[model samples]
Target: MKYTTDDVHNRVKKILYGLTGITLADNKDIMISNRIDKLKRDSKYKGDIMDLLHLVEEGSYVTEFINSFTTNKTHFFREDFHFLDLKNRAIPQLAKSGNKINMYCSASSTGEEPYSMAMTLLEVQDEIGKKLNASVIATDIDTNVLQYAANGVYRYSKSSKEFPEWIKPSKYFKRRIEKNLAGEEILIKVKDELKKMLTFQVMNLNDNTYPFSKNQFDIVFCRNVLIYFSAEDQNKILKKLFSHLKIGGTLYLGHSENPQDLVNYVKRVGQNIFIKEKEAF
Candidate 1:
């Protein structure tokens, strides 16, 4: 069946909102078209956009549709200061308390953020001459990205700009030359030591309740992805994240995000950083 741009936009918007709680504004028409068109060409989808939408409704191509539209822009140490704070402040405080550092990296797109966290934790552990038992639970709504994160392989050339400068990549990642259907490409895969510090899983922030118990995580990194959500949804998710964090735990948000709604529960400690208030329940 023939589909107009409006038809495609409305259909895709519904599918995305239903599945991921991400609302595509009217201005995103071109982006939606480009992504869907790319999906058609790359996946060799024979059907029209409407047919693809029908398939998505039936849960046949849901993952592909979500992966195609959902933005997964991430890099190692994307916000360098957060990692710096983790090393210089957070880890030191946790080390002094002698408690295992439990961190959750929500929206860990393809592993860069979590790996950066793991590396910083390792560095702090070495610096303090103490064995800091640090573990990061990385999760994303996109299953495909989670799988990529689990594999712990990334395109080194593309990631060069955002790669952390303090730690040598060679120390935590081994260079590998691999041949694919396209051609030869240089890739960097995370070493076993860094991989051991992370546990990647598939999770949706829109879920009514997360699987984790209350006060489980000492730190939560729910960065970048919150801007895509509606204000009400953002508040809901933030409250849920707050519940998972320990009273004195830290929550790291994207630089552009505001934590005004959470003022009573968390105190702004730094730019885009909020610490759960000691008296907050």
Candidate 2:
């Protein structure tokens, strides 16, 4: 059962695109086959990749396909400047209005980015000596990652990569050494205070409309995920994200992403950062 045939690969690609609107490049054929192989082993589906694709097309094991295909590579404060800007510039200006600030981490993979947002807001609150009433909604299409995010635990070794050298992990996380059946391992967990600020949910960004109310978010972090989409889909998602943002709200994109079609609606303020025009509404 060779699943690397062009016909089988195209079938799998069509199934993925239909479900998630992600366009797979031809070079990704081997990558897709590898993911499907893992899925085959995990699900114990004693069949070839074509069988898996048929099951996916029949709406069976769809969630597993999505969880397997969607990329979830992220770390806390992966982009340092974004958090700095949020803490020093965005929070301060928004705080001056004395209103609750709403934020959406649109692709909160494994909880790092959303937790980073919480930490930044908490730091600002301590500096101002007042509650910012900041609330964060973290959403991702991958339910498996969402569950891991909700648990808020990670290997200390890996989690250590979350912050920049200047920031200390102890400031935001509580570290503990615990012995398991395997061995003694150090684990880092998100502090309860920071965990309280985030609400995690499963969401598909490919939807025509998001579940959020209009003009709801002050900041939307849809970083790193747009590169997987086509230009038309990227513009479509950007337009939808704009509609969800409040006037003068900010949008953060991945470093490699540029909102070519969205410049009319949002003014670029920083590298891969844009502010919704006050007149956008």
Candidate 3:
């Protein structure tokens, strides 16, 4: 059955608002219809459009629907320059400050960004060794992806091939001795040293209560996740992120995201990078 663009928009608006507390406006007709068509094809729904809408409207299925519609296109070192900045400037500066350094990867999907962060810290291990305490908390809303992240393994053929060999799991991780019931080999082993520095958890940015402390982090990498949020939500999240950073902590956004004249506490540093003003805390 065919759906008018309005039907698609109404259905999707209800679904998104229920699942994410996000309201997709009525103007999003074409985009919503396109997304629903894709979802229909992906889920193999053989019935009418109304039936598909029913599936989406059922609140129990919204999480899977959100994951299906959301984009998760990250790879090892997708933002290469940020790592360079982290190595040359961020970590070095933090080392001398005599503070425990906590960095958060707020939208870490599939583990590449946080693991890449671990690798960068290892590169500067000699200078940063024991001078600065470090911990990385990687959070995402999708539990399926979080499991993959917690496992710290990837299909080397997809995202890891372009990374230098020294950072690949082969340099550190040994193949796990156990197999899933499928009897297929799992493809990763994170070195004990790097693995110790990172943790993965499920966090929903839309929630009113954050699980972390205020003024607690030295840096946060919440990239590529804000594009889906409305401007109002983005502003709210920026404020929340700022509240969690120390006086001079830094916040990194995706190349496509901007603070839109909303934040005064963070000053532009490098491209797509912002440093919290020393006075903000």
Candidate 4:
């Protein structure tokens, strides 16, 4: 059995933060420690807790550690009103130009949020009797989760169960069946239409410069992630995200995030939603 002490936990936390600019909140040591212990057991790592910490500090097995430590909690139609706002408010305005709509979903975990955006785009275009020609870029720091997102499969008990009620899921998803030597498994898979609308990539928000061109995205969703950073870091990230938004593009943040500091650059258009400001559009 493997166990981690307070010192071990602190060192492990520091290692993960240094690698991913994402910090665990206070009082999360128990959860971090448990995951570390699980790693030790699963890998059958011979090193004790402190020894394992040093290995991680020296950048050995760092990717696995980072993958295990990062939080990737998300679901379809999360913060439902954001998608509603997209369908009823933002998309219509964006569709006015008859140009392709571009959306960015940062910290997109396992595809749900971006896919939700795709579903909304599909729904709105159908209602208006026009193809908005929209696209979604879904990004995350965890390679493991990104792979899962690109695969576009979800368990029936989890997100798949909720897919049907949203718009017309049949247009975007299909039943997936799998058979293996060990056993059989069943899941729902995203159809090509939805997959074609999304491009999944590995992105770390901590980078000083993002890969996106300035004023590139028509809608941005950077939800449920700012809580992990310091206030200063949060401001830095928000400014970068704002730079990527077109003048009238909408930005959706986590419900618990504090965006009061960004008043100079953005105005609140809805709950936890802001539109970039230039005083022109």
Candidate 5:
């Protein structure tokens, strides 16, 4: 049996929407099929390709597709300079405010960005000296990635090999073998300090309203993911994100993306960085 491309196209769209609320564009056949093919291979499907399609029709396919489709490219300190800027500028000013500082990682893939953020806050722990209470809320649309983030483990795969060792755990991570869901063995660990400050959740950026309101965040790192969205959707997301940021809070975008062309809500801070100029609350 053979599944027509159209059969795959429709099924894949439904699966993406149901699992992650990601609505695939009609023209995304190649992308969808490519992801589905990867899932088939990962699942070790022993049947015909059409039979594999039927398995997808039975549900649980969305979970498998998410495991394959969601991009998880990240590392321990991919952009060390960004952390420097946070330490030098953002953290100090927020500490002065004497408010409980909140940071959000919007596209926090595989946990690196938020963990880096936690480490930055921890770096200033002595300086702030009880003046600031901080927590990093990391959210991603992919539950599969979120699971790995929650586990706080890394194998230093090809995606993460380039990660600089300077910021690597100082007497923290200790490797220990553990069994996976399939009873396979692997080793990984993260520092207790880093683990305590960060929390990961499954969140869709396109959700009409963020669960938390009151414009509470001091910084929101909504990077890279918007490149995959349409212009209208991107604008919608930015507007929603702005409503959740503290008045003087900053929003970080991908290296190549800009919010300037889209709205006047935030003032430019630096490269792909924007600050909300509407008086702090």
Candidate 6:
């Protein structure tokens, strides 16, 4: 019952790695400890930290344990280039071919990214005057974030932290401004159209097999998540994402992510954007 901080930290680190495949450096003691403390307090677990750790090891709070360590930071329209391609290229190609447009947000986070994708798809559909059936599959490893994402309400402020700088509330959100203790807080709720276009699920990219059919997606956004993985994992995920993507489907990575291993399988079409080559299989 009296486990040291080191004992708690090491067990947590191992559990996080086993469940999510995210490696935590030993120097992340403060982060691990802080998160564990928060989990104990928030989970309302009567036992001490070690007891909670033991529960996690035996799979009681595995989801919460994994959620504690996984970073879920995301933004709407975080990168303009990706959406621009969706608006200008992918949507148009699919529309003209009379094919249903499908997209996957591999790291959808709290829904901003997938909501952004939905907005673009709908806008493109409207502009082209096509009745293209379009939908987005949003998946995240963290159930907590996924719940928030599915709820789709936010406290909008001047800061770019919660809301994006360029998203127009008139287009995709039901705007409501109210004065709270913190002063005038703009609460933007996602429109029903955007909400209906997305389906969120819990997923771990580390899994060898995914619950998707081969060549099912026209575009996939695995952005910013690849950097957290090892080199071998990055390659494995890339290959899997490519396999799930249709020939000529698009893949978006983070700006800082190095995807040199995919040089043979994809063609670089834009900044951090790659089009799955037909020869990729």
Top TM-score hit: 2
What TM-score do all the candidates reach, one by one? 0.92, 0.93, 0.79, 0.90, 0.78, 0.92
Model 1, range 40-133, lDDT digits (tens) per residue?
Answer: 8655789667877788899887777878888999988998999988888887888898888999999999899999999999888888888888
Cα lDDT tens digits for candidate 5, 172-221: 45566676786745455778867988888888886778888768799998
lDDT of each: 0.87, 0.86, 0.75, 0.84, 0.74, 0.82
Off by over 4 Å in 5: 1-3, 10-31, 41-60, 126-131, 156-168, 175-188, 260-262, 279-281
Candidate 3 TM-score over all chains jointly: 0.79
Q: Candidate 1: RMSD over Cα atoms?
A: 2.3
- Model 1, TM vs. native: 0.92
Model 6: which residue pairs collide?
none
Candidate 3 residue-wise lDDT, 1-281, digit = tens: 66676766676776775566566665766667677777677667777767776877764455556766555779887778788888889988887866777899999988889988877777766655654578899998877688888887665444346475345456556665456786755566677887889999988888876899988888899898888788888877777777788777778899999865435767888989888885443
Cα lDDT, model 1, residue 114:
94
Q: What are the per-model C-alpha RMSD values against the true structure? A: 2.3, 2.2, 4.4, 3.3, 4.9, 2.2
- Residue 237 lDDT in candidate 6: 84
How many backbone clashes are present in model 2?
0
lDDT of 6: 0.82
lDDT of 3 at 68: 61
For candidate 4, write residues 59-116 as lDDT tens digits.
7877678778888899888888898899999999889999889999999989999999
- lDDT by residue (35-100, candidate 2, tens digit) is 877678666788667777788899988888888888899988888899988888888889999999
User: Judged by lDDT relative to the true structure, which candidate is superior, 2 or 4?
Assistant: 2
Cα displacement (Å) at residue 70, model 5? 1.3
- Against the correct fold, how does model 2 do in TM-score? 0.93
Candidate 5 is scored at a TM of: 0.78
